[model samples]
Target: MRVYDVEGFPNPARVRIALAEKGAVDDVQFVSVDVMNGEHRSAEYVSKNPDASVPLLELDDGTYLSQCTAITEYIDGTYSGASLCGQSPKERAIIHMMNRRAENGLLDAVGDYFHHATPGLGPTLETNQVADWGKLRKSKAIETMRYLDDTLKSRTYVAGDTFSMADITVFAGLAFADFAKIEIPAELTHLSAWRKKVAARPSINA
Candidate 1:
């Protein structure tokens, strides 16, 4: 299998971290997609993913898979050893819920700030019209983080005690936020501690 990725991006980092956790890093080939140069929008890349997204997985049989969550889930299911997802149905549901929350609340918000506010990769992104929308989305994202910080006070991980996909999603999202100069509020002590724990993981730097 081949994985098209971008360095220094959270979406691709998620997949790389997942591969490390699953001990499947050596199993697949990686093709770097340079986001900084607007390479993702090139005609060659557009043919592979019409939406022009990275972290796309192409199977040996020529099947293409898109989206970080779907691709990561497929990896976890197909490898089947040290599972990053929950073993039980209830656990899986909780993990999925937390993952969705992280994506919608944190990741999407960070994307808004990057694509709409910042002049990402120069002319590749439109920074003129979406500035206000980006600010609004950023405020919403921070509010969601505050709520998540409160929820995390009682639980060791996002979903429960185990290190599942939710934890990975949240960690990756928060890391992206950090890169964008967004800091976790001081009031979110639990979240800060959790972030530290995730950061200390060896695979996170992978």
Candidate 2:
């Protein structure tokens, strides 16, 4: 499989972490895509992923998987190691719920704020920016972080006790937030604590 992404980007980092956890990092080929240069928007790349997004996975059989969640699910189901997706139906549903919340509320919000409100990746990559919408999303991202903090206060991980894709999404979200200069309020001690634990994991080093 070939995974196309940019290094140091949060979404790609999520896939890298999942691949590391699955012990499949060495099995797949990594191809760097330069978003700053509009490489992702090129026709050649768009043919593989029409969305023009990074962290895309192309299977050996010539099938391309674009979304991070879909790629992560494929890795989790196909490889053997610690499962990032939950094992049971209930666990799966809860994890998926939390994962979507993390993506919409935090990660995607931060990205919107960066691209629209701030000059994210500069003017070359960011077009048609809406300052008002981006500012709104920035505020919403913080609000969601507070909600997540509350959720973390009662559990060892997001979506109950085990580490799952939901946790991965939030971890990547927080990392993206840092890039956007959005800080988790100091009062969110539980979220901070949880972040510390996740950061120390060996897969993070990958």
Candidate 1 lDDT over residue span 123-147, tens digit each:
6455365888878878877987898
lDDT of 1 at 40: 84
Over the stretch 1-206, how does candidate 2's per-residue lDDT look in tens digits?
Answer: 99999988999999999998888899999999988889999999999999999899999999999999999999999998777888999999999999999999999999999999998998877889999999999999999999999999899999999999989999999999998999999999999999999999988897
Q: What does candidate 1 score on TM?
A: 0.93
What TM-score, to 2 decimals, does candidate 2 have?
Answer: 0.98
Off by over 4 Å in 2: none
- Model 2 steric clash pairs: none
- Model 1, CA-based lDDT: 0.84
